[model samples]
Target: MGGQENVDYSIVICTYNPDENVLKRCLQAVRQLNVANISTEVILVDNNSKVRVQDLPYIKEYTAGIPGLKQLFVVKQGLLYARLAAIAEAKGAQIVFFDDDNEPESEYLQELHRLNKQFPNVAAWGPGNVEVDFVDGVDDNIREVALQLFQHRTATTVGFAAIKDWQPCYPYGTGLCIKTDLCREYLQQVNQGRLTLTGRNGNKLSSGEDTQMIMLCISKGYAAGISPALRLTHIITAKRANRPYMNRLLYGTRSCYETCMVQVFPERKQMLESKLISGAKFSRQTLKKFLKTKWNRSPQKTFDLIQFIAAHASDYMALDKPLPGFVNKVLTSLKIV
Candidate 1:
């Protein structure tokens, strides 16, 4: 299923229930990537999917032609667990992460390989994404926000740029490539209850795991940046454009910000709280929108925001002390569908 113990790159693609046609196209794109003699392996970790891999037409039909392709089913639900499993099994110095929906360019692998060679001791780097809105009737305003949500851009520099200050720490998980050693280090912190957000377990969208990892790496003297050499097409279908998912996305984004701040700014505990309190409250219109569908408040929205604030508040209280059960529980909790 994979190459020798030492490979130039191990491309990890983690997924839940994926669109079959898009999956085929992505696999085909992977099959066509120009590794150019760089030892590589493509590991597809099915994260507790309901669909059997054996029954998936794309797995049987499309990936037969994809060399270095390995399929591993992860019964664990969260993306963090799937990724932990992937890191344990990965045999590459650099592991490039790709989402199932991303169609990386022909030179994606080669460029990542080049970047790894270029930036020694670099933790991770990723190319910006081109968003392909796959839904009709998406208004310009919605499209604008969706573009920012899906696309990861670097303003300071695009190619091998060192992160001198704390800006957007890393790219989104799509087309994000990291060194295997750093991935292991990041997971160790996750085990220790430091970084939160940035994982998907079924319906729970507590995210920023990617950002947290890169931020942690930077704190430990690792170099990370946005690379222009690599590129991928990130597909956002109509389903994600709906109201419920949009709310989840917004909540997850803020939740991730809170957790990441907790990890990186443990000293500014009171200061963080002040900022949160001083921040603008939810508008009347926004609250009405949350209440329109139901007589009461939206439980999902309420819980998500509560968790977000609690995460930061808990960390603020903890300071250097160990975080208790409650903070980590909500961070990793699965939504009871």
Candidate 2:
């Protein structure tokens, strides 16, 4: 199915087993969007949640008054599949992604319309002010680290251009806006089994689908960016505010980083695979940073750095063989696969 004629934007919300309160807030934010005279649609792609659609009565209440609202029940388990379903059913020239925890400002759609006009060539962009709202208070150390790591406030400038390989400015999943035509292009690659990042399937936090899509757009001579003008609040539950969960999320994202890069930019496979250091030197460097951070009482930063080093080490070790195989071996050893 292709996009419908004269539709401006399709806001897609993909959820599996979301907290009802959080989901309600997310829907309410969408409902409260100030679209003015713009034609829009709301698509809810339920990714096989335990709660049936018939049981989700509040969903209807929150989605009311949207121009074209459709709730789809997708049996596929992963975030990738759920989003794929939305792309097929979307009837808008532009598509915006909203996680179940994202709460957009009332002017989100209006700001997005302005951004589209400003950056006409940029295929993908997202909100830079991704503030985190913790339901339960967190410890000082964890709170500090979480805000720095989880928030997406890194865009110091507002411009669209080809992002370098090492630059960590790719628009994240929250509030990700992309052209519908680019989404159709991505859909073909995903359907052919070329892109495999499932992105937070159930409790498993492995992610990269968002980055993969942006990379695809970049590969096709398009730009991606982030703007502070657009804003959204990420609601973090108590379960995700602890040290253990934080470490897991960090590890999951880091583990999939290299694989996603290789998969998306196969032409640069050799260049990436060649940029590895010896295990002994890498270990010494990692140990030095670890001890220094430990002495400084920054365990979270230490763990975060270790994950990046481990990812590089995995690439270095797998230099002789296929990249994905070596990464998967490391994941299996760590029981992440």
Candidate 3:
């Protein structure tokens, strides 16, 4: 046998009780891709969705419209688990992982394939996330600028030598693509039956799985890139995008950092500690720059940046003292209470 037949591309979407309308819009966007040289197959893996996606009205209508779109096996595991399962079943040479709640531009798949061919060694590619505010209108200008920045520094590494002015971000799970073979090979080593490569505790409680994969690829000499040509809008609900939810998300992100430290570089914990301190210093410097420049930017933007710096400082301080009491003190001082 010549192994699994290599198809053009396999798009894997993982969802956990997503709204039907959002899923419909995402599928509609996929259906609009104009690429013809490469065939596309969508693998919708229900991550044990409580809402029973199959019964959703819009899902039913959308599936009826998009005939021949591959409906692969569904997995009841968490997001990372379902992701791995879909990757394992994928028959395409290129595997694209998209979050269920995102709507990619019509050229998204075409751009990803173009970049993959341009950089043969690049193991992964991602697009900038355009935040879709359900309440407020879409900000296409900000999204366009973000995409431009993302493309300018397409293939870069993390750490000290990271590209200047380019915000270092792992492939966002929503609109990321990687070679199927590369994904399978790396996954085999890290995956411990039932546990995903990133090793989440289930789907809900698990975090940093995507970051873990990105670090693994970097460590293994695989280049990661981003294509401005490929764009996606991440749908944000009022409840999920509010202040309290953001704080909770930040806490989860902190836990992810701790997990990554333990898993990827337990021996280099001291080095990681140094990096955290350095990051805090950088944040302080950036804050000073903003204040000195009298940016007088949007209030929301200013507050967000300040909050990000504070979060990084808190992470650095908690590196040595990983205690609830210490965390509480930091939170109280920061007025996060």
Candidate 4:
């Protein structure tokens, strides 16, 4: 049921109120990518965007000549929902989840295909060269933090060993190339309202949907890894490097990680409860650090550190709030929420 389909690759680009200029760059990258003999399809999902993607002049200007380019509008708001909406429509045996900011190398598809053929158990694969292109004002520290903010990891993780580089990431969502059947299975989980974590939605800056899917595959003895040859550049903006944005990004990411943690480790319920009980103590320590570091080294660093600590506490305390999603429903069912 996978590669039996005619299409070789279905490139799914789901965007929500994206930067038009960067989105244009992404489309251009796709247009220029060397597909050669690959039967590729491009699916653009407008995730209820404020500015419809098709309305953008570049929609015609850039993607006009490209074949198999289709426009899809996902009424749902979340990034995961957008991908899920496109998955049902994808005819290709393989699907590559692309962000609007991604600029793939010419051989992106060729490289992924090469690796997939080399490793059949690989359910989801990504590009290793997928990285952040920081804007001007970014120094080394800020750039590092910004990369962390986006979960762009350079380390290549192929299987269960992939869990080590989980610095809030496994393989990034930018150029995630996955098998169709695995994508369908993940989509089914989404349809059943299982996974409580939703990926980035709008400008909220949260994540975890990617990791959950990969982890699910791993649980089933499938591998999630990277093809070093396939490359993609993530266009960065100054806003993502700012202190306030980092605070929100890290805070939301913390919630994402905790939610995914519960799903991936259902037996850790008692541990999560302990974290909830000690949340106040953690918050107090974070406040103390904030007070001391307010006048210390880089205010942004000091403040971001505080947010990192407080984010964990916040997720712990909010363990009671009912949300629309849950990862492992059986485990979460016993939650006191």
Candidate 5:
């Protein structure tokens, strides 16, 4: 019932209490997409935001003016739940999931179309997320450049995986795309409560939902790639740049391991073994990098890297036993539940 002949693409954005200006800017970016053979439809899924998003000015503008744009469905659930709802309602052959806080460059949609055409077997694609520090009104070019260098140095880093096909160890939900039919089938499984978005009670910060989806697609013989050409600026507030948030981001990585083992892995023994080996390798590599860095580096950057590695180590240690309950407890204490 959701399919319609006119629609070629569906842009699904899941948001909860998103900054109004940022959300509007994101929509504006989508509006700037180069419209050609493919017609675009936007599906905005609101996850019970305290602020009424529909009341935002730009939403009204789009609802009133844009012709290529389709319906904006508002679902009052958590991010994953809202994403599932949007997937169900999407009418396009291809569905792109975007974060409300992200503003894409003009070539965003164009690159996806180009990549899909180049690799028809691909089930998923992602763009490099450039961070924009809003408080200072400055782009984190240093971070971006460092990230690029890191990705070039390693094959597994998320940024590197965006430019080529790699067995994605994790999924970055921001600016990721999947075929609509596959998304529907996957969400149906999730709705049946078989595969969950793991990490805890709907906290947006936790990892694994996107990674799990990509892994499922891979298991089904579908391909996934990162289109280096498509880029988006992920707006970052000062709060998100702080050490506490960095630590949470680290702990969040561990949740990815737990989720993979508990939700996707078929055999406990195999899963534990795989988790431990992968975790140990990641930890070792991280420690090696950490120790090699110069002491003259910025204190903030050093602390961030240290916390990130610590989180990875903690994640590896967690894999020593089955501790889904413990993972949930941590999420609960963080009020992520």
Candidate 6:
């Protein structure tokens, strides 16, 4: 039902409003894959992009001559929806998810194939070394935060453990490889509206769809882990690495903490509820730190701290309004709105 259909690996790249040059670089890297003798396929899922990927002048130039198979699908939705679309079309045993900006190493497929064989029980595998390259060159001010912002991982290891204990070791959306059947199972839940997290949708930066999928696999007794052998480079545009963009990303991350906790770790619902109930006090303490960061002119850290305060304070204060209420207040006070 899977690889028996002739596709052994399905490389899925999901993109939305991607820069033409960046997309070309990503495709160029894909065209350079050392696929050996294994049958492979590349599926590009354009997530409701303003510009159709196929219409791009340089798209065919980069995607041309890429071994086994190539496909393009327009999901016209968020990241998860686009991924689900790719899953529906993928005929390979393993479905590797790549962002439009991700450039995989030449041996990426070979390494992933080896890991799949070595750890058959591990349902999902992540790249161990996810290096970041800024298109406009690295800025000294944002250099440190940029690495964290882009989810760069330098740790090298090959092990499958509990998803919770793995920390940042678990697979992220970039260069994430999962079984086709598992992806198909997830697609069914998403289609049935059982899954609530929609990943990032246009202006909305909320995420954790990848974690949700990994958790689902774990719940079904399949493990998730990282392999040092798998590697990829995440190309960051200058516009995306700035304070404003990072602020939105951090805010999205903090706002979705409760959702991720509730959906991925349902057993900890009581703990999360208790924490949120006392969030007013936590918010006060966090506000003090936020003020200190503001004074220190650390926008990245300030937003990171404040978003947590905003998420929990809204819950504790029993605000009928959205989390933005807290955000608006803080932003007004900081004069950043």
Top model by TM-score, which number?
Answer: 6
Evaluation by lDDT, superior candidate among 1 and 4? 4
Reference-based lDDT, residue 219, model 4: 65
CA RMSD for every model? 6.1, 3.4, 6.7, 6.3, 6.3, 3.1
State which candidate, 2 or 4, has the greater TM-score. Answer: 2
- Number of clashing residue pairs in every model? 3, 0, 0, 3, 1, 0
Better of 1 and 6 by lDDT: 6
Stretches of candidate 5 above 4 Å error?
A: 4-6, 62-64, 68-76, 128-171, 198-204, 267-337
List TM-scores for all candidates, in order.
Answer: 0.77, 0.87, 0.71, 0.83, 0.73, 0.89
For all candidates in order, the CA lDDT equals 0.66, 0.77, 0.58, 0.70, 0.61, 0.75
Off by over 4 Å in 6: 1-4, 164-166, 277-279, 300-304, 310-328, 331-337
- Candidate 5 residue-wise lDDT, 226-327, digit = tens: 655767777655545453454455455444554454454554445445545353456455545545445545544544554454444444443544333443
Name the better of 3 and 5 by TM-score. Answer: 5
**Cα deviation of 134 in candidate 5 (Å)?**
4.4
Whole-model lDDT, candidate 2? Answer: 0.77
Q: Candidate 5, clashing residue pairs?
A: 162-226
- Model 5: ten consecutive residues of lowest lDDT: 148-157
Q: What's the lDDT for candidate 1?
A: 0.66
Q: Candidate 2 on 1-337: residue-level lDDT in tens?
A: 8557889999999887778899989988998999897889988888898887536878767777766888889997889889999999888989999989899999988988988888788888888778888877777877777775576464555756676463455588889999999899888888898877777776677567887888888888888888877889998888788776776676666656766767778776777645766555565666566566557866666566547655764465334333334444444544444
Q: Please list all clashing residue pairs in model 3, or write none if there are none.
A: none
lDDT of 1 by residue, 1-337 (tens): 2223878888888888887767777888888889787888878989878886656865877777666787788886788888878887888888888888888889988877766677776677888545454544454545655566566454445544345334554566778888777777787777777765547766766556776766666777777767766777776677675555655565565545645756765665666555542112322333343344356454445444444544444333434433334433433442221
**Superposition TM-score, candidate 3 onto the true structure:** 0.71
Residue 10, model 1, lDDT = 86
Report the candidate with higher lDDT, 5 versus 6.
6
Q: Rank order by lDDT, top first?
A: 2, 6, 4, 1, 5, 3
> Of the candidates numbered 1 and 2, which has the greater lDDT value?
2
- Candidate 4 clash pair list: 194-326, 196-325, 196-326
- Compare candidates 3 and 4 on TM-score and give the better one: 4
